[model samples]
Target: MSGRQLYFKCECLQKGGAFKFRGACNAVFSLNDEDASKGVVTHSSGNHAAALALAAKLRGIPSYIVIPKNAPTCKIENVKRYGGQIVWSEASVQSREEVANKVWQETGAIFIHPYNDGRILSGQGTISLEILEQVPHIDTLVVPISGGGLISGIALAAKSINPAIRIFAAEPKGANDAALSKAAGRIIRLPETDTIADGLRAFLGDFTWPVVRDLVEDIITVEDSEIIKATKLCFEILKVVVEPSGAIGLAAVLSDTFQKNPSWKECNHIGIVISGGNVDLAVLWDSLKKGK
Candidate 1:
């Protein structure tokens, strides 16, 4: 770890405290004046909700956010602070979708999917653009996979700029849909997510499947404990406060997953995308103290 450097494209520090802002802003601004006047709606538990809310505010349009009732307090506050109109739903994925669709139908608000839109992908790809500009040469780009939006965008962008640069994904073992989907050659949805990384609970979307399947070099999964440990490591070593989901890429790196890879022999410089930083500090501390 002495001579080796792990450079990070810190989206955690971005507006609304996550990379979701880029996509949200793109989606919001993509609408024409006529359609934009009706505003937009989205189903999200945390970061995306806050992002879309803020984006709509900047565009001077309304934002309807469908959130799970059990979503984190901090994230809920962020959405409210951004002036998002809240629509409560059950924790089930179906409920979230149903509510968002209902709002869009009733209000004629444009439905801006969190990760399935083309414009969203283009906006998220800007992260790779910035990375390339900031760090010209790197062996690989490691991104955390949720619904595959971030990874798919980064893969497409990075591969276009540097075909030799490898793009890898870090996913949670408990919610291993991305890995399973990549292997089965299709998007796979888990019955339920079982990880502390709340932001990554969603399965891959239609738009991101092909991009991730074709461009990503590999997908590595880590346990919840590994993510928590990696989160602490980021704070201790890198002096960065990263949430569990945000630190999964580092978790994969610190684990044997990377070292065991065939590409490890040739890869020296690595670039990681720190996806978000909206974690609840009390929960993290309690979990760490209890060793769970």
Candidate 2:
């Protein structure tokens, strides 16, 4: 009765068009009625901001989102459509954080950190919890690492439920700060990051680093090209439209990064967290045509 025979947990169908909703909902629901009514603020390039916006809306609370000026227009629109108040900042990551902080100071809004808060982590952890229940026995779990909140939560939940379940964090090679930090045994900040996977662009947050370092088994890097290919493959094979960052986990597995392990062949029960499906249609079409 090995875990490999169990079914896979397809979280791509989660609310808000990504698995992020789990954590967002969890964090928002955990807030006391008073704090929740005070409203919330967060900074995100895309998916997380939308998740928070939707979650806050569900809670009958207002949300302020700080997004980089150059963030995908689709993501910005999603945030606004979900009832979030958007504050635009310089396209750079630093400015987004600064703007979010400024909003917090001015509004005195409760800051619902995108990845660093314990409540957020616990919320993200629920993805793994559901996966385990759905699949029953999962041998390997693949997750994309951005600010490390998602992977950190999944790793903790998966490991606690079954320590034998190996957890790997997939990241874009261009944005490999998490991998470098893991190797260095400390948090490493990238001076500059240039990756089409906007969701994975940020450096790991302080709260997320420790959980990832201690709980995660390994961090693997994938090229941007591979991510593109994987994204297209998901559209073709799974009939799911995944953003570049969301497809990293599947890209790593399909690219043979973990194929060398004999255990993988014997126990083919690999659970990939297909995190989001928020790609811009125009960008997707252009990338496909260019790749072809």
Candidate 3:
């Protein structure tokens, strides 16, 4: 939105329609044949569930997904299409974990956490690995954070290659636990949240919190309206259909956060990660009407 130059690292175009595929693939493949034979299990609202299901299918292994009842219909279809056995639960974090734990216990399946696993971090890290190669002189990266996998991986990889790049996180204000945690200098969890960024509603995981706290320079939270506005812009201007969670990075730029920061002036070349492209067309049309 500013006069400064910005480049987009479009992970929305990645497989399974999100960068979660990278982590899911890595986590699934890291398992041995005997382990994979027992199958794999996970709890997710959408993207990660679909990714892990697809990953398991590719490895010729079984997948059992514990999906929240509120998860998107398209995403549920994706998991089922990938041959994952679906188990439903309430939308709470407690409900998701309990259902997954039961499935894991019954099947003795390997549990691949959406963001808490190290192998998943390694897989997601590959995104920045490519960004640096393509844009060697990039001075800053703007990424969306939910459970923090994408930002954690990108921050770690990008800094390792060129310690010069500054990493920033874009989060929704309605579910701004990450931003709150950053400001508090410790981890924080919300018992509840309300936001259109469904993929980003989860509280930050323990493993991801440390990496995000240490490596991330700052986090900027935008209102739900701001998120919708950015989502509209992505579709109308960029000709790319981005979900609410995916558009938060561009929303951060349009918000006062980027402009108010003195550090932003130092960043001549910035990279923005388009985290996913799984917006429901029904919701997209509704958001478009609101944006107008």
Candidate 4:
């Protein structure tokens, strides 16, 4: 355990069991009546798909979800339960965008970029406001980075409120595009990603990259093994069900990269964003069986 006062901002217990619902709802409800009539469309691996589907359902509009063939079963089921029209795609960003484009063209639906839109970023930023209010004295936040929406939004809002507050991005080493981008001082896209934390596979988008570059304190990369260990700790010790991506913030906090950092010595009151809880039981059982 980290020798710090770790305050958990549990977005895992959100409406769609992930912080994604905040952005999806904002994007869906922000649409005008005419645009809403055409419905909404997007591509996602899992959490965002379910979030958008549920948001559209609440707004009485259809949601077209282009999902990769290899998305977690539990997430796919969530989309189905929320009445989304599923469009299957190959497990690649290009394939997902192509399929989503086709749907958008055919249906004339408003396209919602999962983590790249300003509306979505503002919605996710609400987390920072809530966190600061809930833990007034906290000076740092450890957030999991995927497409960069969550952390970008957080860094923007948190820094606006408390300029001295630190915002660290938590990333899986396998999908370390953001880390690479931060280091190279430019956006870096990975041709392929290989990470057990499916939700963290995405790279930063144009809108998110600028905020991350300027406001984020640093990137803490953790191994998949470390993520699994954090997931196990959440289940056994914290009694919280967290997906691997959601637990990556905790993983990063416990990682040697963070522990060994002399600059972070004064960051004693830390806040960790538990981003989601939509775990695949099969994956969970398998990891437990392997005792990782």
Task: State which candidate has the highest lDDT.
Answer: 4
Which portions of model 1 show Cα errors greater than 4 Å? none
TM-score of each: 0.97, 0.93, 0.97, 0.98
Question: After best superposition, candidate 1 residue 216: deviation in angstroms?
Answer: 0.5
Superposed on all Cα atoms, the candidates' RMSDs to the truth, in angstroms, are 1.2, 2.8, 1.2, 0.9
Worst 10 residues of 4 by lDDT: 283-292
What lDDT is obtained when candidate 4 is compared to the true structure? 0.94
Per-residue accuracy of model 1 over 29-109 as CA lDDT, tens digit each? 889999999999999979999999999999999999999999989899999999999999999899999999899889999
Error of 3 at 244 (Å): 0.8
lDDT of each candidate versus the true structure:
0.89, 0.83, 0.89, 0.94
In the range 1-292, model 4's lDDT, one tens digit per residue, is 6999999988888988999999999999999999999999999999999999999999999999999999999999999999999999999999999999999999999999989999999989999999999898998999999999999888888999999999999999999999999999999999888888999999899999999999998999999899999999998988888998999999999999999999999899999999999988788879767755
> In candidate 3, what are the lDDT values of residues 1-292, reduced to their tens digit?
6667778877789888888999999999999889999999999989999999999999999999999998888889888888899999999999999999999999999999999889999899999989889988889899999999889989889999998789999999889999999999888999889888999988888899999999999999999989898888888888887888999898998788788787677877888899888778897678668763
Over all chains combined, what TM-score does candidate 3 have?
A: 0.97
Alpha carbon deviation, residue 25, candidate 4 (Å): 0.6
